[model samples]
Target chain A: MNQLNSTQLETLRNDLKARGLSLFVLKDELLDHICCLIELEMEKGISFDEGRQIVFKNFNSAEMLRNQKKTKWIYQSKKFKRKFKSVLSAAAVIMLMMVGGVEAQETPDGHPIYGDCELASGFGIRRDPIYKIKRMHSGIDFKAKAGTPVVATADGTVLEAVSNPDGYGNKIIISHSGEYKTLFGHLSGFNVKTGDKVRKGDIIGYVGSSGRSSAPHLHYEILQGDKKINPELFISK
Target chain B: MYSKELMKGTLKTIVLKLLKEHEKMYGYEITQKVKDLTQDKIQLTEGALYPTLHKLESLGYVYTEKKEYNGRTRKYYLLTESGQAEATEKINEFAEFVLTMKFIFNSKLAAE
Candidate 1:
């Protein structure tokens, strides 16, 4: 079998690129796959172009080329979407988990509000409505009527659902993959219990003035590990 | 040629078992290895092979190691620690599935 010289390989690369095999890793693998196919064909005593013809006839489907993009996007996006549940035993080896980690970003579906809602207040320090003192707001507050259904921001397990007196009146915390936790505060009621599985946009409770609140609203907090970061980093008005 | 449906259902398990036995392999090597072992009866097309490999990689079951081969960079897939464990599970699952298939298919009429 004749080996494909560098010029022949380069020409093949351009041929594939012209046909939309531009995804780097896939293009590289296809280059190798095509080379192997051509070599195998040549082993049968066929000429180089004849072997190339066979490879092109087989691999040059529009559907196959479309897969180059679709698979790349799915892999790239899911690479960022962490689901530690399936294989937590090997999480330690995933370096991406160490750096980027799982984060609460804009969920690709309906927002946490069930019907009508607006941002009453956002993440950052502001003057306490009643106390009139500047204090840090740990989460974003959505203004909604009491008993407005509140959905989960992402897929997670209900971590806690309790009415505490000290602060955060009736609250529900859901633990997501990659150590992401979302807190829903001032709920009038809960639709989920601790350890219950919830999906993105799944209604977990009803908004209310339950905990340390002056009005009916939803206090949404996104926590990385345990630290409360800006909910706006992920959600918005 | 094998039915695409059967191949689709079995491909992940097959790829996982192959990776478990081979330790590491490039895309071409994997296709070639499977063809050789199965006597070309189960030829895996590029369309099927790549999407499966990418899905596995995204699932954290496999990781990539890039190496320059024949003046071009080739991405080699190596099973992660969890991937190896998953491979064993997949193999056993497929075995059980086959057994279940036998029980279902081999059952004769009760003469009712």
Candidate 2:
């Protein structure tokens, strides 16, 4: 394997540092992967300079940095105190209703209003565009262009549609039957407000790159009472 | 270049054989081992390696443990008991295949 020169290693170190990875965290194996790729390209008649360019173009530095941040957040978030007790408090009331043997009326088709959906981003560790931290994605992202109509995923009453400091940008939450709730975040504008009755597929808002998003995407979530479930399991793909 | 179809068939066997020898490995380590063991005849890219690891993990062939190393916590993967058994079977299967192909090719050369 062709070894990288001191200058080349320094340049790589600086680039990684700029991307939020500390030198202490640099894994020799990952560095070797980069070096091997460069050597392979050089053997293919590509010049060293050209190989370097190809490496930078193909490997996503931002995404790698984001993954590192996510690893940190996963460990730290477990210890952070909960700020919103009200959300959990409301969930308890819904749990009690279910325990009382009151079967929540199932809507026609027994499916949430929206039938087809595509995952924009999964709920898990991801690079936060705003904070540059590896944080819990918390929700699924849906592909929605700017001004594209956002629909309610289920039959529910709008619980909140106020702009607050939670960094959801312009967000809305709806309380559906069976203690289920859906959250829509990073909305450009909202059509439904608090206490508005909405059916599945109702145009509740428009997609926008609001509040902590790097691009225009709809952050959709489903919560059973307070705990979030994988929306992909419930939504039609 | 080897046909993509042929490469796909042996990929799982190749990965399993490597992991069978080591206690645990991460994405980069797995890729490096493949290249070294093959003497640069084969190369595994990131796009290929990650999806395979995830699929193997999901299939219960591999399990991951996060360990703090070099000031960063990295997820290392190790084979389960089932995975070890599968690895032995795959290696034997592949070895028999190579022997059969070599005998046939050498006989053809001698006849020519």
Q: Which CAPRI quality tier does the interface of model 2 achieve?
A: incorrect
Q: How much is the lDDT of residue A121 in candidate 1?
A: 91
Which stretches in model 2 have alpha-carbon errors above 4 Å?
A: A1-54, A58-237
Best by the DockQ measure: 1
Give each model's clash number. Answer: 1, 2
Judged by whole-model lDDT over C-alpha atoms, candidate 2 comes out at 0.71
Instruction: Supply DockQ values for each candidate.
Output: 0.38, 0.07
Per-residue C-alpha lDDT of model 2 across residues A1-237, encoded as one tens digit per residue: 455676766666565566566533233435545665677777888777789889879887665565455544533443342433456767888788766634473221222223243456788899876788899887788766777777877777999997754578889998887767888888888899999998877888888778877777788778887988777777652
Candidate 1's DockQ is 0.38
Off by over 4 Å in 1: A79-237, B109-112
Lowest lDDT 10-mer window, candidate 2 chain A? A106-115
Clash number for model 2?
2
- Residue pairs with colliding backbones in model 1 are A169-A211
